[model samples]
Target: MQAQTMQAQTMQHKRCMATVNKSRSMMRTYLSDEGVPLSYSRKRRIAMNLLKEYIREKYSSNEEIQEKLLETLSVYFNQVDNILQKTESPIEKTMAIELLNLIKSDSELGEIGFVDLEPQKTIKLNNRNKYYVADFLITWKPTVSVNGVERKLIVECDGHDFHEKTKEQVKKGKLRDRKLFLEGYTVFHFTGSEIYEDVSGCAIEVLEMIRSWHLSWVHG
Candidate 1:
């Protein structure tokens, strides 16, 4: 079983490398012709141009349809997951359980927990055009960061199944966390003991950490 898991991970690595090569090739193609690497914003601007043209032509008669299409595109291009979409996850249950704990400890922390149904992470990896799921992905209101991008808090419950026990595992975990950090995500790892001892305290710690981080851009 361990062998199979290793094999699967190897295959995933190969596929990811292939994708990265393909992306780099495309970028080189544009750079060779246009003398500039096709940046993400430029690509999105071109896509928006094409999409707007298509919508204008396709829905020429219905201004309402055009308006809606533009609205959808605007939202999609600008943001990621909608936190208020009634998501259910471990954090939601924790919120319920910790609801009372925080109230007893601190009124501010009490409002966090499961009330904010932290959805799975939506990671944009350089090698893969996919989202890597985290246990919980929370966006605090007043979410924008110093770089004008939305900040996110990724809560990971580390267990034997998903955490580092070996040296290689530790390296892999750190690389993953570094990638997440590069993309404006703050990651917090909690052991079973921590969560078991004080569920509300853990939740409150995450809330406060993220809150302090958000405030730091302006205040700090």
Candidate 2:
């Protein structure tokens, strides 16, 4: 879809919009170079409110037209996630690419929703500057009703080179998991084998948990 709205906002940022379009056509998605996202609310976790707005408006009555919108978004995020792999453990690196492929390579997932996948992203403490680099940061869009929100989650991939771990490391892992939980993030841990065996199953498990949490938010 041609992101014609972006051109009117800032002339200097016009090139940012072009990245979303195909090489043949100069189209782009909602991400831009402003460096500051359009804010909405806490529940609406989407960084670019414009994208969500476009989705809602079009979904409202099926009358809005953003030609090739889905195709446009498909090309929105382009990055070399392997940049962080240099510092990651072998299993960590593997999980990173697998999860990225699981989302990007899935056409059905693309049609119903979009995801923001950032490797080595920092998650700050709820009220403190202290933060940790998450293995993978994921946020799924097109959130539906259920306490009126669809929360984000954290997936941690653990690797034991010799299938053994020190007690100290185990303690620290639990501490970090609890801290993430306290910060309102659903923390999940998968062994190298578990994720490698069937990343799709691992992903499906995560999605199911998110849905369960949404329902519990409203009913519990």
Candidate 3:
């Protein structure tokens, strides 16, 4: 996709128009850029009115009201993009790259590096065609044992799924985690808050788990 089109699609998927407008307003305040105080509630009401106008315009085939809503959305999203770009932190970028590289390496994890361990990395665990994306996957080449038998080192990653919808959804997530565990996979889970608050600590915990697995395989 063209860069602008891809960006638009990403924004559409990541945020609703209402959220865009609200965040844009908050960002403007943070930046102290020149802008009037925009009330989220009022803006939402205006959007509802616009929707009404849209229906009327559609029945009359006027298209003007529909064009207006599109224009408003475009401007709102642009503001949100600018605000986010300005406020974006380098730590998030660095951490993402660091975490990704840590996962890719074959070195034993320390208190610093963790890998995504979801079996989808070694086998198709999730029927999603896409492998399960996790924080770490630890695996060892099949090794010969003292009895001349072979073994496969296990891989597992820590997963944190925020924004689980309802109670049922949370229950389903637990079931899925249980199923993954039953399939000879180890699963570690954290919340987004934990990641943000104590990233280093979380990384350390993951590394310890991976190292333990490695040591057991070598000594077993």
Candidate 4:
């Protein structure tokens, strides 16, 4: 009877494993679809976590499974990186990389400043068919304050060809800025020329703004 019970349990486990694999395959197909309405990074992270939990449950004793999972994850990450690379201009991308590196490398500044690039913020237009994308979004938390004061910042790295090429483009940019300001985001614009000329200086300016806000929160 014990041997029969063990065999039954084994059969049930195999069935469960098959179901899990089928579910994972379906999830991968959904995530890989371009029309899934999720950012590449977000989708990649979700897929990675799903795989991680599945491996932990089913492949805890198997090194080969772990290796294969890592290989698959690497491919997903490369695809996401390629998508991001194609989305930005060379100069703007360089500036963003430099600024992020500078912010992360600073001990104190890094503690308070959290940065995300090309994060989507959906604003409903009157026509209900339009929205704006902010270049960078930063969340600043003041460490010295017990009152939990924070700031949401939008940083726009404007390219000359795209943002300021014509009067109408410039006007549209201002309108977008006003809309964001109305929505309670502190928007700062940095031209590509300024970023290229002094990337560190631009970072310093942003850091200074964060510091000022922190001090205000601390004293108030």
Candidate 5:
């Protein structure tokens, strides 16, 4: 009986060790990806913390549980990668990372299901070969049907130097907004200063918009 109990304990230890190794491997792979900018180390740390918290909450010392958790971690990593790859500029990238973390961490904001987040989405202009690339195109889970289509949102981070310096750029931006509106997307534009100065406030405003949409869907 003593020998049998010792063997069981040894097996459990091995399973736990395997889980730790698998988690570490996943983290390393995720961090090493080129899509993740080196400047976004804080975001990386948050991702790691979230992963660890998830594992702690959901898994035990069981090997099977660890395997399942690892699968979930893969999904999480994919989601993060998708968001990170949406922007190349430092300010935009920072804002995206901050907004993503806010959404993931906040219970109220996290409830809004995001179906797809495409960075640099290309849309052809009406009956023309010309196309415009949106900075971020987010497809939310069907809250309300807008003309039989799920509602979508566009997030544009504008830099002062490029977007505000030229009247032509401003005119083009307005045209782009009109085009997106025609395509049934609600647009939100945040300047570099606004994003850098008050990220949390910006996130709150976004949450309010989502909440309003959700409420409309539920009521209507």
Candidate 6:
């Protein structure tokens, strides 16, 4: 089994290399003959000739960049898994989620686990191509009845900016929350000071949302 796994990995690496090469070749072709600044009078004659020459000389069929990107991705994924296992903080975990599923791992080795349906994630919207990356996510387990069936929350660790530019930041945050609502996620933002001042209160609010979700699920 170990031997077969190694063989499969090797085959995958080779296929990745081939794909990298093909993409690199195509990019070079596009970049090389795309365009050039030209003199007014000699523009017509030189443009096509220069473009052809540029394409021929500058375009090299190489997989160097592709190979580098693949290598970097592999390294990042490995590091991300390492960090996830090592850290206990909610903030770190949130950052990892923000990075998304670009990280790849071998499932057979137990590198991945099932994630239960929890708070919404930083989902991309094709229309705006934007998503929220909150500091923490919570869910309502069926047993704990509170806000509704499921509720999503966004917690922002507000800094000095939140106080200094209070009005502006609040406006922007509300706008962001509005966008999140439109995207089907409930957002609850809190400042760092608020958390520090009323840690228990913050905890209660989170629990209340969970219970609310649970109760909704029960009633419906």
Q: Give candidate 6's whole-model lDDT.
A: 0.45
Q: For model 1, where is the 10-residue window of minimal lDDT? A: 25-34
1-220, model 1: which lDDT tens digit per residue? 9999999879855543443333333322332232345643575566567667766776688687567657755664343224313224433333322422232234343343222434555667776675677767666544332345345778777656545699998898898899888777888888756765666578778667755755664474
Clashes of 5: 0
lDDT of 6 by residue, 1-220 (tens): 9999999879866655454334333322332231534332243234334433433343335356444544644454444445445433433333333322211222211222221322324566448867655544543234344344444555444545333266886797778778877866666665555644554455456545654654565577
TM-score of each: 0.45, 0.51, 0.38, 0.53, 0.62, 0.39
lDDT of 3 by residue, 48-116 (tens): 455445445543564554455456545654433332343223232223323333343323443322234
- Clash pairs, candidate 5, are none
Model 4 residue runs over 4 Å out of place are: 1-87, 110-130, 143-148
Model 3 poorest ten-residue lDDT run = 149-158
Candidate 4: give the clashing pairs. Answer: none
**Candidate No. with top lDDT:** 5
RMSD versus native structure for model 1:
21.9
In candidate 6, stretches whose alpha carbon ends up further than 4 angstroms from where it belongs are 1-121, 141-150, 161-168
Q: Supply every candidate's count of residue pairs whose N, Cα or C atoms clash at under 3 angstroms.
A: 1, 2, 11, 0, 0, 9
* lDDT scores of the candidates, listed in order: 0.55, 0.54, 0.44, 0.62, 0.65, 0.45
Tens digits of per-residue lDDT, candidate 4, 104-217, equal 445577565443434334445454477776666667765555454567777777887655688998898888778767766788888877876776678677777777776676
Q: What is the C-alpha local distance difference test score of candidate 1?
A: 0.55
Please provide, for model 5 over 4-62, each residue's C-alpha lDDT reduced to its tens digit, 9 standing for 90 to 100.
99999898666555554455445544553447666455657766776777577656555
Clashing pairs for predicted structure model 1, backbone only: 95-114
